[model samples]
Target chain A: MSSRLLSRAPQDTPGTWKSYLGLGVILLVSAFPVYWMFVIATSSDEAVMSSPPALIPGDQLMVNLREVFTMQDVFFTASLINSLIVSLAVTASTLFFCSLAGFAFAKLRFKGHNVLMFIVILTLTVPNQLGVVALFIVMGELGWNGTLLAVIAPGLVTAFGVFYMRQFIGHAIPDELVEAARIDGALTMRIYWTVVVPAIRPALAVLGLLTFVATWNDFQWPLITLNGTDYPTSMVALSDLASGNYVVYRRVLAGAFVATVPLVVLLLVGGRQLVRGIMEGALK
Target chain B: MALTDVRHARTEEPRHAPPKRQRFWLHRFDTKTFPYLMIAPFFLLFAVFGLFPLIFNAVVSLRHWHLIDKEKNGWVGLDNFTKLASDTDFWDALVNTFGIFVLSTVPQLLLALMIANLLNRKLRGATFWRIGILLPYVTPVAASSLVFAVFFSRDNGLANWFLSLVGFGQEQPLDWRAGTWSSWIAIAVMVNWKWIGYNALLYLSAMQAIPKDVYEAAAVDGAGPWRQLWQITVPMIQPVVLFTVILSTIGGLQLFTEPMLFDENPAQANGGYDHQWRTIAQLIYRVGWSDLNLGYAAAMSWALFLIILVVAGINALVTRRLGGGK
Candidate 1:
């Protein structure tokens, strides 16, 4: 399929030029808002509000950064740490639990397996937002309201992750290997840890990266669960900064830029893998 | 059949072999326990966080309780739900939510499909274009909404500047945050900008999954690219199209941050300019956090959940019919 796609590359001709032009226009329209973000981020506040509006970069970026730090104290450093810890914790825990369950559902002989799998799939449509009000009360009762754990706790056992990993492992891992390991007297956990894990490494990598990115970008749950008193994730901090009544536009932009840089870097570094994962997700 | 055979073999030799039977039972126990052990964490976590909260929220919805006045809590039965049913603000917010959902999701999906088709063509710099499109999806929502706020400002903003360039210069800049329709438009634009690319990329992936032989065969039959796209690619990716539609309905209905932040008065939980942009999620937050009416907020959340469930169900039914009744 890929080879055919590659071989069908249109030669440079008037027809090809017309296709390219059409695509170029589409790309420009799709990408303009993001470009305008960086443009305004670098422009002065006055220039941003000018009659014509600044299309060119201004020289107030440093000043804006300074103001953002002084005014919001977004605790940019702390927020970054908080985001990192929460995302990593969610990713690691999800990978561990999801893969274990996925392996069991795929390779193990267990009673009620079909029923359990059905239940997991059924929960997929139940959006997490439905439980937020109750979740808040639970957190309040547990005295975990202001902690990063509150944000990470509900996300750790995503039904999507388990279902996705099950499909991946079922398709990617061979039944013969598990049978061979069993015949060789390898324990179930040992076989899973050593054999299944290595075989499904690619799927695990995709799921892990996706979980990290989603957790990092999450807003609603964190907004409800994490009070601003202590550990503020970057999204929460950015929301507070933007909503501040006395906020300066440029500094807010700077803070926005600061918040966005890590994601950009991650995407650039893992673009191929991320794209492949998203594609696979959509296809499924 | 295999289980019966194994059971018959086990029972046949069990009269004089208690130790062997004990070992067999232990092996069976190990086999059964392994899967349970492996899958326990998810059930455990869900019980604590997902299931318990859901049931508790139902209970909370039955009471008349404010967060600040815990001792004054009283059994309200169905009063909160009845009150919300009659509330004008809730109805207005519900209307605005659906309005924005239609305005944003329909165009966003269409544009996404078109762009995906464009990207699917044999072109240079396809990788760059694909990554560039994903930029908006990855950008922080708060940041993107703030950027939109600046760009859509009534005075001295880029959108107004462009409008002026097109001979609306003498008129006043459009007050995007003022009335219901204008606020909905701004909210739609923000949503469309953020999500269109993500959907486009999703469509692109689905397009890529189509076997090239089908398209080639269509081409051989004298079909143009446009005709081939409609007759082949669209039908093949219909499942993906359904997926995106349902997913967007879910996300779009719960939208809060962009409108909440873009409201003229950010500090106020009430969406600005006569509550023009108030969405159900925002209203839930306002009732719970701002107004301190926890019971009412819980009821609103459940109401919103029911709305999502119904919308999602309708979407599923429509998509199933559209997907050739599969």
Candidate 2:
């Protein structure tokens, strides 16, 4: 394993300037739209219509943000707060429930474990959106049609999260550690709380970050459930701003730019882990 | 603090052990029933919110249901499905969905493969490069789609300006959302912009897992860089390539958000004035919510689910053949 790790040293993969140049161009294309967003967010309304359009940041960011916040049609600030509450609630519950279930699947052998696990893996391929029509109806029947509960409840524990946690726990927390805990008379819940949680902290972090970003960026369900209401999430609110007969590009981009800052910061801080988690989730 | 408290309490567990009968019961509960309890939430939620809805969609599609008039909902027995069969709008949306899927996914994967190869080498500021490419992926779809909508706007948009700079489309700037092919290309650009880097990173990780010795041996056998890439890198990453193809197939077929926001009137959920780029998802949304016909929407939803499954299966089959034949 150590030799394998050593083989990944930079000396082995000698890169050329052509590759660097290609990457540079790709990065520029990746970043320009975001930069353009910033430029329009900070510029005047005229900048959106100017010849060649604004490519540099202007001083009207405060002005555009103020316009967006105080606009009577959309609840921009409330949407941000709503997104935070939903994302955090979903992340917390997903972690606790999935980890507990993952531990049960991994270490604590029980009846029907393989069958139940197969079901979980199978559900991963079936998009939940396939049933959105009935789901919306179900929400209405349960009197949760317009509430945040409709969004938060179904997402509290995802099949993907359960499968991911199970994979991580099975690999990271060895059977011997679990055996040792059981031998010490640790109860199942006790063992999960003590031995399992700490061992899967990295997995928890990865899952947490991915879930938060995904929830924050989620659009379709939230749009259907919360559009035109005062309780819209940030993404729905941004869509609201984008639509309409006459969209103020400055205000629209300003709201979008503000909503995206937190996710960008998350990407900057936990990017390596986030990338690893995504790749691992796909490959495994 | 909680962990340490648990540990401290654990060390003194034998001093005040429970009675044998109580311990036996506790042990039984812990070993036999606890795992079921741990896993019960997932099954319960899935039954209520996942499986039930999926199965119920068939029932809903078979009936005549409206969004607001609950009293008038009645059994119609596949009428909605038959209506959908002759619906040109639905067919157009299906065609648009597949059109945008092909246009976006083909280029996105190809560029992602090239970018991954570039990134799989030693480079300065590697973290910057990785994170930089992922900028669009992290941006909210609503936000990025709106930004792209403006960038592709007809008169004063950057896309037109660039076209002029390249000595084309100077007289009449292209109205991106007005034409069928133009709107698909515009939405495809939005889809490709967000996903290319993400797919690149996935490919890069897979590339890193290929042992260095394989490349060294290939190099020693007089395989140039291009030959090594085709014979060694491409063949080795075939599974990952197939995996991404299926992934994109599912995602591309269910195209939403980008085109939904790209619409001139998003509240109406119309893809364009001519229904140019209406996707199956948007069509479902329009029929269900805007038109308030839940039964037809449910039918469309099931059809979409089947379509995705079929397309994904075909992609998997074709990819396996291509990989193995080579």
Per-residue CA lDDT of model 2 for B235-264, tens digit only, reads: 777888888998899889888898898886
Pairs that collide in candidate 2 are none
Q: Give one digit per residue, the lDDT tens place, for model 1 in A1-284.
A: 44343334222112367667876776686567656766677778678778798877777777777766665446666787899999999999999999999988888978899999998888787777877888888999988898987888888878888988888888988899988887654678889888999988888888887888788888877877664565788877777777655666676677778778887887787767777788888877
TM-score of each: 0.90, 0.95
Q: After superposition, how far is residue A1 of candidate 2 from its true place, in Å?
A: 30
Q: lDDT for model 2, on a 0 to 1 scale? A: 0.88
| Fnat of every candidate, listed in order | 0.56, 0.70
The candidate that achieves the highest DockQ relative to the unseen native structure: 2
DockQ of each: 0.43, 0.55
Q: Candidate 2: lDDT of A57?
A: 98
lDDT of each: 0.80, 0.88
Scanning candidate 1 chain B in windows of ten residues, the lowest lDDT window is B8-17
Which residue window of length 10 is worst by lDDT in model 2 chain B?
B4-13
TM-score of 1: 0.90
